[model samples]
Target chain A: MISNKQILLLTSLLIFSAASILFSLLSGSVDITLAEIAGSILSAETNLNSQVLHQIRIPRIQAAFVTGGLLALSGAIMQVLLRNPLADPYILGISGGAAVGALSAILLGASGFWLSNAAFAGALFSIFLVFGIANKFGDWSVTRLLLTGVVVSAGWGAVINILLTTSSTNNVQSMLFWLMGDLSQSRVNLAHYLLLIAGLAGGLLLSRSLNVFIRGELLAVSLGVNVQALRLLLFFSASVFTATAVTIAGSVGFVGLIVPHMLRLLGARDHRFLIPSCILLGGSFLVLADSLARTIVAPQQLPVGVVTAVIGVPAFILILRSTIRK
Target chain B: MATLHIQSLTLEVAKKTLCRDLNLQIQQNESWCLLGRNGAGKTTLLHSLIKQRVIDEGSVLLDGTDIADLKQRELARKIGILFQQGIEALPATVFETVMLGRHPHLQSLLLDNEKDIEIAEQALAVFELDSLKARPVDTLSGGELQRLALALLLAQAPEIFLLDEPSNHLDVAFQIKLLTVLTDKVREASASLIMATHDINLASRFCDNIILLLEGGEALVGKCSDVLTEENLSKAYGCPIQSVHSGEHRLFYPA
Candidate 1:
């Protein structure tokens, strides 16, 4: 039954998404008009204004969209994979894994490729560790999985702290800043790579399996779903999506944990709708948050991570309240 | 036509032999009821047939094909079993829970097709669960969920139905309703059904044959009238028993 409410919500989300994209393009530090954005795309543009609009601001906008979309997608998938509403990339220990990797690179004086590499490696390692510990205890119990994650996260956090303390002040500042998250250094090419590979692979492969999964494990298995294989695939896909988000935007939190639940609350539980909705809404939310961070105190940019938390916390609470009321 | 042959099947768990040298054959359209007191291995034997528990010796064959040769999916298509108070992980809708029975028939990525829906709908209608199709299964009453579970088994459309205490947690009306539906399904599909039940009367009224499980892995397998005797019931249940028979129906009760 395709209700009118569903149609209305979908249409409004789309309209809001278009408006948010347009608004993000217009509200950067070096202001560019809507016409200029269009003109920059249309023209064979090499002029200063066109260069700023096309080369710098456009890439940043795209990066924000990709990162935001992925984090939310990961969150939604994690919820179903873990069989808990509170589950997200962070709760599944991906954030801790990525954080460990990013912190290690910073401590080691690594730059460029080493940063993203360390982040990805750390994320995968953490997931594998949690999977191993949980599996070792016989069945894949949810409590055991989360508890193991909590323990590992504590250990990883302690290690990151030790590394930070032992490092020079300059290194510490950069490490701390990355931990807080930033969007200033985002590259279009890297964002494109992360979005295309992780998004397509995770979204397509897992979406169908997720429908089976949401029905519950026994039913999923009875339906010829290989539970073990699917869980591993889900962990790997979500880890990759999460790690890429961290590497690009530097550990933007809560978006990966919150947005998917919002989509579910809005009556889009089917993965086909949920997967895309998370992607679009996540990207849009981050781009808007990033724009506000850049311009809220113009000429003195706040970290996008800080902006996200500030906006995300209140909005998350609002969503939570509305969800509970419903 | 389907035939299940258990030849000298024995099951031992934790160094305790629950059943030993159990030879039985259930052919197409046959219905068998297992009557026993608690801990008599009726449940264990039922579980063994589904491979949920290992058989210590011999083989279980469907149509002379050993169960070991058939993969789980293929075997599932031929046999559907329901456990009492089965696991429910989430609040799955009645339609979705029933649709899960179609899993063995589905391909990797293809969504549920018209045939699958038709089968699910028919199963739902058979158990009078069509109105509750969209309702969350967890919200269902025990009797309703039991009916829904039966609908799920019907959706599988297996040749053999193995039930363990299928009447548990059901009211008298639901119990009678379940027995009637099961009997109707067996008749219409020409399917073999084996149910392990505590109610001797229910078994005598509905079953074509009865297996009386006594203590220490001993059992008497024969017609319902022969197996449901007071002597066997007293020996099996460790209690004085009597039989009441009127017309074609016979019932056993503790004296």
Candidate 2:
């Protein structure tokens, strides 16, 4: 099952991710020379270059990569759980609900970490709403569950629209930009990194269960997996992941929807390989995309979400074409 | 001892009564056929044994153990079923798909043992799926998938087999081939089989016992020869039925 082609792709993806991290630390409004970068790494820091490298760029790059990996892995889990190719980490309205919560908190004069907490709460709320609605009478048919998610997501979208319309005009521009997804002020804290790492490991550990669960509930049950319990566990874990991603960088859309799918195209069918590959590829994809967003126009920044779709679409098409050929 | 015993079972589906006060026992080494027309409660009755649909009025015992008392894993190891339409777009290969039958017996959560692989390989070869072993289940045809499913069930190595419309999409040649293989397997293991199929010739060819389920929960259950008569089939199907002898075999058809 471990083809050399897969090994090569995996190795290349890992190298690309590492390289992206290094380049992200280097390329920004304040460009540190290669010598300065090396000197900072070699020695201690009294210089502003090292300060920017460690405090600003390092954590920002880490946060961006973690968010990307979390979203992509979560999206992959959701796709199999819902059995819909279009299912994403935010398909259950987690991001939409997060947006509403974050926006409302901002409207109420909450800033900084509180806004992210509120967004996380909103994601939890959405997860509970969807779970409750679908678990009614124990009917967890894929179509019903999918329809419920879409409808709830639409409801959250309407609430977001209303919040935008009702908010004071002064806060409107900033909120709109945040809604479009900006990570410039995102908290690149230690806890966020730990959570992402733990989530990735947990996903790998559960990948075998996912392999059975993905096929269908009946088969999962037949295989002695408690399908209902596994479903709840996957749904909530993915919700938490989407919450983390949205809390970090607003809604970086296509990384979640596209990275795992692209990995699948490269013959990473088993979840054991698929989940970890998603971690590596997703981290590289968004880090590179965010780097482009920061340096595309220099000094003036676009939201990374915008850059993500633009980069993801054509890359996905090429991958799709290659996969179809195979 | 009976492999499966259903006691006074009452089942209802979508406001229609599928069975009521139904009692049956399937002994080890026996192959039983559920002979009935569409909606004759063949599927509903069979599913109750696996705890898919809970019966309100009675209990199904597996080796004198109440099915409700057994956990999912133990029950799965004891009784395996092939549904009418299994997962078609499963991402696993035929080998992997068949290997999944080892799940109930797997001691670890992540990996399968070589014995599990050996058993799966044997089942795949017997079911004629060895050539498609590496192909993903999604890429398989209906007949191929059917054979793969049967191989998977066989790999499970359950004591009781419940096959619902097991030959729905199979060609005649494959149907005979698969059943002939299965017959030999069950005899060797002294396991029991309960198959719900529309093909009467298949029942006459393999089954030792047959149940003719009539409307209103009236059932005629006995030896295959005694219960699968034209009068009972016509009454159950609500149509004219005639029995014919083709040399050494018996076949039933609509008149």
Candidate 3:
């Protein structure tokens, strides 16, 4: 028998996703009618306003949806991989490492085309470093992995701070803005970016072997799961997804840390359900958060990160409290 | 038929020899009990037989194939292991936990089919655990959990059953019940049942064969009547042990 809360959550996510896309199209700084926006998406050449709407608004909306969705999915997968309720996307130092890479590339005057690449490489490298340190201790203890992740994150944080201190004022502002997470500057094709997200999402869904891993590494190995290979593969894919999200929209907070657990607390433990729910809800939540950030201050805008944290913390606390009672 | 051959198996952990130069065999249709005092490596020897603990300098062969060469699932298919203690912290229902026995049989993507459910239900029926099927495992009393573990092992449908201290947490009645149920299974399936126990009397009464393990790295494997002598018990336990026999059953008492 299915719980009513699960049905409610699934229903709410679908409704929110539809509403978020509509809001994404309608409620930007400059208002555009729904009909005109539809016309712009359908026939860009027929309407002058269509060109501005298609180029500027559509990508921003898609970026918010995809990045938010993927980050939440990554958070869910990572928590299960570590078997710790508190684990999230940043627990492996992926975001911290990506920040260092993105900032370094920016400060060193790299072209816009290379920014995402540098960030992806940095995230991969930091995850490898953390994994190496954890391996040195001879077991994948959650406490060891968490401590190692913190140390690696601190190391990357120091590097980014040092770069910021030495860089010119102009570069520092850009670095700070990116680190704060802004989707206003993203202009990538939605189809291309969605493909990467879908692939990583597919890989995570295929990790049903992870169910055995949840029992313990020894149990997983004894159950015919290649524990080491599966661990490395999961680490690599989760980091790539996080790095791509970072590259696309700077570094958004809270969504990656909060949404997957929220789904789980709402009774979706199976990854097949949890992962897709995260995608839909995460994308919709972030888009809604971004929209709120734009409109809350009227003519001025707050950072989307600030909006998400403000909205996410209380809900997260409520979920945490309820889960403990359970 | 399942046969296990352990040739000179030794295990050392943290520079202490847990088991040294141990050799044993279990043929089909045999119920063998390992008798030892605390820290005498009875459980370690059982673990070695099941391939849970890697042997240092020997080979464990099952049905003529090296255990190390078998895939974990394949090994599990041939041998069912009941741990010394129940694993807590998982909020698994008795049915779900018992269904885990089918892990070796079912693919990860597929749900437990009717055949798997039938096997699990049969196991539950054998152990008389159908009434407690929906209870969370952690909530069960020690005896109930032990019975549940036995049911799980039965569901695994293994050719050999390896149990570590199956009677440790049980009451006298449950202990006898567990042993009788296991002996019955061994008889019915033509499977070898190997158990580690500190209760020599229970071992002698219920087991067809007994291996008396001494603390100083010696193992005496033979019939129960041959191994449970006062001299051997006292030497292995490092204390004065007196024995009394009633019919085929022998009881060991500390003097």
Candidate 4:
């Protein structure tokens, strides 16, 4: 059953998400005042402010929000799937594979759309590689899967280093930006939104079984959950979510790891509440971080990944401390 | 009524035969105890009965249907198992943990109904854990955790219960109380019970049938009066055992 406190938390997160989106839109290089934004929206004005809002800010905000939602949702699912609290979307080599793809693309003079496609293809390749090796014996244990993922991730890291070492200085800077997660050139379409919504809906549908699953695999099996089927679904779903997010944002860090932990610390441990709350809180967190990234240096933009870690580490520490005190 | 029939079953672990040609018929409302020392295959036998473990040979049937043919959900409705180890520490509350027992019955994508909540609450009350329903499971003590596990099994209400070392970590008083409650529940529901344990006295006191697993894959299975003798237990345990009759009850001790 959903408690009143959980309902309140969800409501607060929804409000926070809206406010963050608004803040990101209003505070850019050329700061548009509240009245100017309102006038542009209320009337069909072709003002410069409106042009910037429609063409640039709107798409970037959507990309950031959806990417964050996808990452956090994947992280939550991964923690349950691996039954390890430290497990994030990237722990399974998806991000490393994507990094290798994007780095290689940068070296080959591929920019924009091709770079994104390369990253996505790399992510898929890593997903299958890890899965194929782990399930080679027909029945894959959790330990085997985790070990396989870790080893594959290490291999990807080595390839990424080689690409970085051989690249020219100018190419290296762009490669570093991509590695640190830049959203300046990021955009989203209808499909990204649909994927986020589908992921949320699917997560909610599986929430109850996930609650039982967290206890243990054997316990879930005894409780009539199709453990093998549920595990396969979780693996692929988390992989797809991670792949899509990395493709859009280039390995934005900490949002996935911190958002779900924050929700759990705030007493929303149930999957039904945890899943939706992860989307709301994660999207808002990234929006706020990206806003700070854009405005803190004003035009000389820091990477969103740096901003996320800068904000996320201290916030996570505070939450962890308070929970331990309780 | 539900029944379990094991036909000409054989089991091995790491090339060592655990049992051979073991036939057992567990009828409705019966209580069976598996008594053996460490590595005596009590747990292995229990797992095999529920199809959780692969048997070397033969079939295990639930009401004349082979268990291998049944889906996991179908099997869950008819049988429940309590593992030997304590539950892992998680962020779930006591009530939420017990409510998981209703998972097999609840439909997908639907919230638990009022009846499911009531059942969970009643299970908590039965274990004297009603006051701690909202407490996190990780905070429970060993004895309390054991009681909680038993309460969850009660809520599950399967036709057959297979427990591995069910009495582990329980105090003397709670041990008797909980075992009595289990036997009473089994009798009232006309369900069967198969428990594996090292406590000979407890097995003699609670079970109607005894299965003594001995060395080299041999076994002795019969009524409690016939199978729970000093000679049988000593042979099964690889040690001398002495028994004394006290007020219509026979208690065994190491000699």
Best by lDDT: 4
Q: Candidates' DockQ values?
A: 0.33, 0.45, 0.35, 0.70
Clashes of each: 1, 0, 0, 0
Error of 2 at A12 (Å): 3.3
Native contacts recovered, in order, as a fraction for each?
0.19, 0.35, 0.20, 0.70
RMSD of 4: 1.5
Q: Could you give candidate 3's per-residue lDDT for residues A1-326 as a string of tens digits?
A: 13466568778889989999888778866778988877777763656567556776677788898889778877876876777877777877888888888898998788367877787788878878888888896767667777888788888889988989999999997788778887777655656466556744574555446544665665454344566667766666777777778878878988987898788677665454566688888889899888888788978777788888998999889988987796
Candidate 2 lDDT over B189-214, as tens digits, reads 88989989898889879998988788
Chain B TM-scores, listed for every candidate in order, come to 0.95, 0.96, 0.93, 0.97
> What's the distance in Å from true for residue A83, model 2?
1.2
State which candidate has the highest DockQ. 4
Residues A1-326 of candidate 4: C-alpha lDDT, one tens digit per residue: 66898889999999999999999988888878889888887899898889998888888888889999999999999999999999999999999999999999999999999999999999999999999999999999889999999999999989988988999999999888888888888998999999999999999999988998999987888888888899999999999999999999999988889899999999888999999999999898998899898889987999999999999999999999999998
The TM-scores of all predictions, comma-separated, are: 0.86, 0.94, 0.87, 0.97
Q: Taking chain A by itself, what TM-score does each prediction score?
A: 0.89, 0.95, 0.86, 0.98
Across A169-195, the per-residue lDDT of candidate 2 in tens digits comes to 977876776776777787577777787
**Model 4 residue B34 lDDT?**
94
lDDT of each: 0.78, 0.83, 0.77, 0.90
The candidates, ranked best first by DockQ, are 4, 2, 3, 1
Clashing pairs in 2: none
lDDT of 1 at A256: 78
